[model samples]
Target: MSAAPNLVNLETVSKAYPDQVILDAVSLGVSAGQRIGVVGRNGDGKSTLLKLIARTEEPDSGRVVRTGGTTVASLGQTDTLPDASTVRSALFGDADAHEWASSPRVREVLGGLFGGLDAPSLPDGLDSRIGVLSGGERRRVDLARVLVGSADGRPASVTEGADLLLLDEPTNHLDIEGIAWLAAYLNSTKSAIVVVTHDRWFLDELCDRIWDVQGGSVFEYDGGYSAYVLARAERERQAALAEEKRQNLMRKELAWLRRGPKARTSKAKFRVDAANELIANEPPPRDAAELVSFATARLGKTVFEAHDVTVKAGDQVLLEHLDWMLGPGKRVGLVGVNGAGKTSLLRTLADATEDRRPAAGRVKVGRTVKLAWLTQHMEDLDGSWRVLESIERVAKRVQWGRKEMTAGQLAERLGFVGGRQRTLVRDLSGGQRRRLQLARLLMAEPNVLFLDEPTNDLDIETLTQLEDLLDDWPGTMIVVSHDRYFTERVADETWALLGDKRLRMLPRGIEEYLERRAEAKSDSAAPAAARAKAPSQSTIDRATQKELSKLERRLEKVEDKIAAVHADMAEFATDPGKLTELQGRLGDLERERDEIEERWMDLAD
Candidate 1:
C-alpha cells in the first residue's frame, strides 16, 4: 500500500453569509484517490465546502490551496445550466473539432446509465433543451458532465476529466440502477471524490473517510458511514462523561467561592477566573430532536378494494385488469423503470381507494377512508406560500395520542428551521422543498399514504430520520422510490411493475423477486455448451429415482409414526409427560417432512 498524493487542502477556511455563519475556520484536505463523504444537516455548509474546493465560491477568510497541477470537476446540487442550452451542448460541449467527440470513455460512462434503458448503443435525449427537460432528466445530464470530465460535450482536457470530483446530492435524480452504477464507479475509480449525498448505501460502499460537518467544523472520521456512526456515538458518550465531571467540580467550586473573604487572595485570582470560565464554557444539555409520530383517524374495516381497474395514458396502457385490496397497516413498495407507470399506478390506486373512482372499473373505499397522495412532482405546492403557510394549508394541527402540536411545531420536527419556515416555497432549495412536501403530508395525517419518490433530494441524515417516521407509521402506505434500501426498510411487501404494465405481487419480498428475475435471465441466456456440461437428465433421473424411491418409503413410515403420535397425543392430552413426548416426536417428523420436501424440489430443479 502507498500513500496518495495531496490533491487539495483548505487552511483554516471560514465562510459566512451576511446573516449566518456557514463554516468557521474549518481545515480539510483531499488526497488523490480518496473517497470522502461530507454529511451534515441542511444549511450546515456541506455545499459551501464543496463550492470552495470546486472554486465556484470563495471563503470570507483563509485560503483554499490546491496542488498547481490538480484538475477538478464539480456537480452542484442546483442546476445553473442556461435555459437555451441543450443537453447535448451541456454534456458534449465542443468535441466536434477534436477526437474526443467519439471518446469511448464518454460512451462507457453513459452506457452504464439505467442499464441501456434509453439507447442501447448511445445516449438519448441529448438534443433536448435543458430548460425543457424534466428534473430527473437534467440530473442525468449533470452526472454525465462530471463523469466524463466536462460539463459540455467537449474534448476532455486535464481539467475537464478532473483529478478530483465534487458532487453535492448526486443521487438526487438517480434510480436504483443508476445509484448502483455510481457506487461501482466510485469504488473503482482512482480519482479523488468529495461528495455530499444523503444516500446511505452510496457512502457506506464507497467512502474511505467521512467529514461530519456540524457547528461550523468538520469532525473527520476514518472509514465509511457505519464507522462514522460508531465514532460519533462514542464522541457523544465521552462528552457526557466530561460534562458530568465538570458538574461535580462546579459544585465544590461554588461552595468554596461562597466562603469568607479570607479564603480569597492574589494567588487565588487565577482559580476564581478559571472557575468562572468553566461555568461559561460548560456544554449545554443535549437538545435531542423530537420523535415524529402522528395520530391517525380510525380506518374502517374495508380500507379500499379495486376491481378490474384499468388506467391508460394516451394509447399506452399503464395498468390493466388490476384487482387490489389495501387493508389497514399494510405497506407496499412500487418499483419499475424510470418511465414505467409506477406513479401512474400509484395515482390510479389512490383514486380507486380514496376517491372510490377508477377508470374502466368499479372501485370502492371504506366509509372512513382518508387518502393522501404525495406526488413526485411537487409543482402543485404554491410557490408563493411560506413553508409554514404550506403546512397550514394542509392542516392546522397534528396529534399523536395525548400529545399535539400546531403545523408550525410539526414543521420544526421535520427539520424546518425558524427562518426556513418563513421562507417562500420558491425560495427554498431542492432539499428544503422536499422537506416542505413531507411536512405538508404529515400535517394531513392521512391513514393511507401515497408517496412517490419521497426519498428524492433528501440528505442522508434527514432520509434516515424520515425512515424512523415511516417505521412507526400505523397506516397503509404505497411508496414508489428508486431507493431500494428505503423501500426494503419501510415496505411490508414489494409490488413490481414489469415492462408490459403487468403488476407482480411480491409477498416473498423484493430480494426474491430480483433473484427470480436473475435466474430466469441466466436460464434463457445459458449457452448450449454450458447447458450440455450439466449432468444428463437421464443420469440425474436414475440417481434421483433411486433416492426418491427410498425417500418415499421412509416418508411413509414417518407419516405412519406421525399419525400414531397424533392419536397418542389425543389419548394422553390429560397426561403432561406423555403429551409432551408425543408432541416432541411430532415436531421431529415435521422437520423431516420439510427436509424431504426440500430435497424433492432440488431434484425437480
Candidate 2:
C-alpha cells in the first residue's frame, strides 16, 4: 500500500428519512489511492452514505470532515443539464467553451477523461446537442463534467475539484468496451474512488476494499470480491457462535429468576433484572432461507420455430432470412448495441399466432406451450396498483417447493414486507418495481420465458437468486441483457445481433464476441487506400461456414451433456434409482459425444 493521507472521514454520522432509518451513527473513512466498492440490498444506505462523503448532503447528526483543500466529484443524475444544451455547455456550465477548448492542456485532459469519444468538433457541431445524443452518450457527457472540472481552466491534479470520485452505477449505460476502458482508467488514477454498482466483474477486478452497507452500519472488508465472500461467511459464523452463547446465558438466567420470584426479594429482583436485559439484547435471527423455483409442466420437444424471418422496425432490418428454433432446455442470450431491436424481435416471437404472421416471417409455437415475455417497459404491470394488488392479479397461491404458499408469504420472501406491499408502484424505487415485476413473472409458471434486460435496477442479491432460479428452471429461456457477467453465468452461449441482419451463436463466449466486434470496428475504420491494398478475408464458402457452425454447436452441446450427467450422478449419489438412471444416460451421452468428435475430426481433415 502507498503512503497516502486520509481523504475523508465520517464521525458518528446518522441519516434517516420519514419512513426509515437509513444510517445510524455510521463512521467510515476513505484514504488516497483507495479503490472501494459499496454493496448492499436495494433501498439500503449506500447512496445516502455516498452523498455524505461527497459533501452534497449533510447527516442528521454528527459531522462529515474532509481534509483541507480536498475536492470531490460524483456521477449523479439529479443535476442533468437541459436537453437542448450543447455538449460544451453541459460540461462547462456557464463558462466560455472557446476559452477552455483552445487550451492544449484542457483539451488533452478532456481527451484522456473520455478516450475514443467522437465528441463535438472544436468550435461547433450539430451532433453535440444533448437532446440528439443517446442515453449512453448523455451519461458520458455527465461523467466528463465530473472528471474534467469546469471550463474556466481548472487544475488537472488532486488540488483540483475532482480528487475523490464517488460514482453510483457508473457502468449502467456503458458497453463492453466502455466498461473495459473505465476499469483501466480507475486503476491508473490516483484519486480515491468509491463505486456502487451491480457489475460483478467490475467490482471483482477493481475493488481492493469492500464496504457492506447493512443494518444501519458499514462493515469494511479488505480485499477483492472473492476474498470478501469468504471473509463474510467466516464473520457470519463467528456471529452465530456469539449468538448461541448469549442464548445459553439467557436461558440459565431465566431458570434462576423463575425458581422463586413471587416476592420481590433483593436477590430475586437482581436476577429478574439480569434476565430482562438479556432478553432485550438477544441477537436477531438470520433470514429465512427462501426457495425459488418454477412450477411449470414438462416442455415438449419443440418450443418455437421461425423460418425465413425478417424482423424489422420501421426501415431498419434487425434480422433477415434468419431461421431459428428453440427446443426444451434451451437458454439463449441476445446481445447488441442499443436500438438493435432486441426487444422488438422478442415481442414478435411471443405474439406470433396462426392467424397473423410476425413481420415477414412464419412462426409456429409448439403444442402445450405456455409462454411469458417480460418487456423492458413492464407494460404488464399497472402503475396505479399497489405491489400486493399487482401480484394478486397474477396468482393468489403458488406451488412452492413441498407446499403451496399464499401471495403474502411469497411477497415476503421476495423482500416485500410490511408497508411495502401497500406501497404503490409509482412510489417504489426502481429496484423494488423490478422485483415486483419479476415476482409476478415467476408466479405465472410459464415453461417458455422471454426476458429483456431482466437485471436492470436489481440488486446483487436478487441477481444471484435469479441465477439460482434459472439453473434448475427446466424450461426454455431467451434473455436479452447488457450485463456480461449475468449472460455468462446463465446462458449456455450468446447470439450476436450482427449488423448484417443475422443472429449468430457465439459459443466461444463474451470475450470472443467482444474480440470479433473490435475487429469489425477496426476494419471499418481503416482508410480507403489501405482497404484497397488488403486482400479479402471472406474467401470461405457460405456452405462450409454453415457446416462448421453446425458442428461446433453440436460438439459443445454433447460436451455439456456429458458434464451434466456427471453432475447429476454426484448430486444424487445416495439414491440407487437415480444413480442407475444417470449411469445409463452418461453412457449414451459419452457415445454420442465420441461420434460427434469423429465427425468434427473428419471435417477438419
Candidate 3:
C-alpha cells in the first residue's frame, strides 16, 4: 500500500482568547484521505483548531501550511449562504441544468441530501429562495453547496474530490438517514475530512483518527471514537499510576513516558488490555434493572397513554390515529424524518399545547406522572439571570434518585464551574446556554421527562455527563433527538414516526428504522419496467414461498439472539472467562444467521 500524502500541516500553532488560552504550541498534519474527528468540551479550542487549520483564523504564533492549490471547504456552525440567492444559484452559480446534470457526483449529492431536486421538501425545487427556508432547510442547502463544490458549474471531482473538507457540526440538522448517507458519501469521496461534531456514531463510522483538544493542547489518538476512548483511559491510568509511585508531578510525567519500553510498539495491545481492566474495575454507569424497579415503585403502573390521537401542522397530517402506551420506568427514543412529527408527539404526550387538545383523540396521564419538558427553544430562559440563578429559580435542591444535589453541584456537573455559574446567561455561548437549560430542567425533578433535541450544542464530554445522569434517573422518559449515539445510550427502546400517523416500535432498533426508510425510498424510486420484470409472489410455488417466509422468521430470531448475546457480553465484560464463553456463542450465532441469510437470498433469486 502507498502512503497518503500530507494535505495540510500546523507547525507549533498557538492561539488564545482574551480570557483563556485556546491552543498552545500544537502541531498536527492532515494527510490525504484522513477522516479525523475533533472532540472536547465546548470552548476548549475544537473550533479554534479547525479555524487555524483552515486558515480562516490565524494562530497567534505558529503557521499553517497547505499544499499548493489544495482547496479547502468548510461549513461553520451557522449558515454562511447569501439570503438573497436562490438555492440553484447558491449551489451551481449560473450553471444551467445541462452542466450539473452531467456530473454524477453532483446528482448523487443532490439525491442524497434534497431528494434529487424534485423533492416535495423543496416546494420550488432548486429555485426556492434561501431566505424563505427554515433553519434546517438552510443548513442542508449550505451543506449541499459545500459538498457539491460547484459554484462554477464544474463537477465535484474536478473541484473537491481530493480537497480538504473542514466541516463544523455538519450533522447538526441532519436526521438519522441523512447522517448515514453523509457518512457513506464522505467515505466514498477522496477528500481528507476533519469534522467537528458531537455525534459519536458519526465519528466511529467515518473517522480513521481522533484529536482530543483539552487544556490548550491536542492529544492525538490512533483510531475512531471507541478506540480513542480506550486509549485515553489507558493514558490517564498510566498518569495516575505514575503519580502514585513517585508522588512528584514532574517525575510522574517522566515516569509515565519511560514506563513502557514496548509501549510504542504494542500500543494497540496496551489499549485492549486497558479496556479489559477498565471494564472489570469500573462499575456500569447506571444500573438499568435497579432504575426500572425504583421507577415502578415511584410512578405506579402508567405514565402516559394516547388513544386514537391525531396531530396536524396546518393542512399536513403529521400523525394520525396513533395509539400508544407508556409504561412505568420505560425509556423510549423517537426518531423519523426531519418533519415527521417527533416533536409534535412529544408535545401531545406532555400536554404542552395551549388547549390540551389533539386533532382526533385523547391523552391520559397518570396521577403520579410529573412531566418536565426540555424544549428545543432557549427563549424560555431569562438572559439577564446568571446560571446559578436560573437553576435555583426552578429549585435550590433537586432529588436525583435517593441522592440530593445542591444547585452549585448540579451546575458543576453540567459543566458550569465556580466562575462560570456566576456568568450571566446573556454572556454564555450557545453550548453553555444549553447546559443551563438542562440544569434547570432537572431541577424540577419530574418523574417523566420529555427531552426534545437535548443533544443540540452539547459537546461530547457534556453529552457523556448527561448520559451518566440519565442512567441514575428513576423515571419514565421519552427523548426526541437526531444524535444516534445519545439516543442509543439513553433510551431502552426505539420508535419511529413514519408519517403514517402511527407510532411504531422498532424491535430491531434504529438500524431497522433506517432499513425501512431505505426500502420505502427504493420502492418509490423503482422504475415501472424494472418492477414489472420481477417475478410476482403468486407465480412462485406456495410451498417454496412458505419455506422462504419460514427462513426469514428464523433469520430474524437468530439475529435478535445475536443482539442479545452482544448485550450479555457487555454485562460480563469484567469477567474474562464469561466474556470468552459469550464470544464463542456469538460467533456460532453469527455463522448460523449468515447461512440463513445466504439461503434466503438464493431462494429469492
Please report the TM-score between candidate 2 and the true structure.
Answer: 0.71
lDDT of 2: 0.67
Q: State, as a TM-score between 0 and 1, how close model 3 is to the true structure.
A: 0.79
**How many clashing pairs per prediction, in order?**
10, 0, 1
Best by lDDT: 3
Per residue, candidate 2 scores C-alpha lDDT tens digits across 365-415 of: 787677877767755566799999889899998764455767876676667
On residues 142-226, what C-alpha lDDT tens digit does candidate 3 reach at each position? 7887788732234234235438888899997788899999999998998889999999888878888999998998999987776
Which number leads on TM-score?
Answer: 3
Give each model a TM-score: 0.69, 0.71, 0.79
- Which residue pairs in candidate 2 have backbone atoms (N, alpha carbon, C) closer than 3 angstroms, thus clashing? none
lDDT of 2 at 231: 51
Tens-place lDDT per residue, model 1, 1-605, is 87888989999999988877888998889999888999988778899889998778888999999898787878887777777876656765655525444565566576665222122212123555778766766777777778877622233542336789899888876766667668877676668999998776677667879998887888998766655654554465467733543344333233323231231221121244544443454332211112112222467566767788876543335678878787776778887654446766666666665454655776777777778887767656778889888889878987643457798777776678588788988888877887887888777777778887787777766766576556555667888887765676567678887545577887665556556555654664476334333434546757766776555445545554554455455334347877667677778988997887677557656
After superposing candidate 1 on the true structure, give the runs of residues whose Cα lies further than 4 Å from its correct spot: 79-104, 114-135, 151-154, 157-161, 241-297, 353-361, 379-396, 401-408, 417-430, 507-605
Better of 2 and 3 by lDDT: 3
lDDT by candidate, in order shown: 0.67, 0.67, 0.76
Assess candidate 1 and give its TM-score to the true structure.
0.69
RMSD in angstroms, candidate 3? 14.4
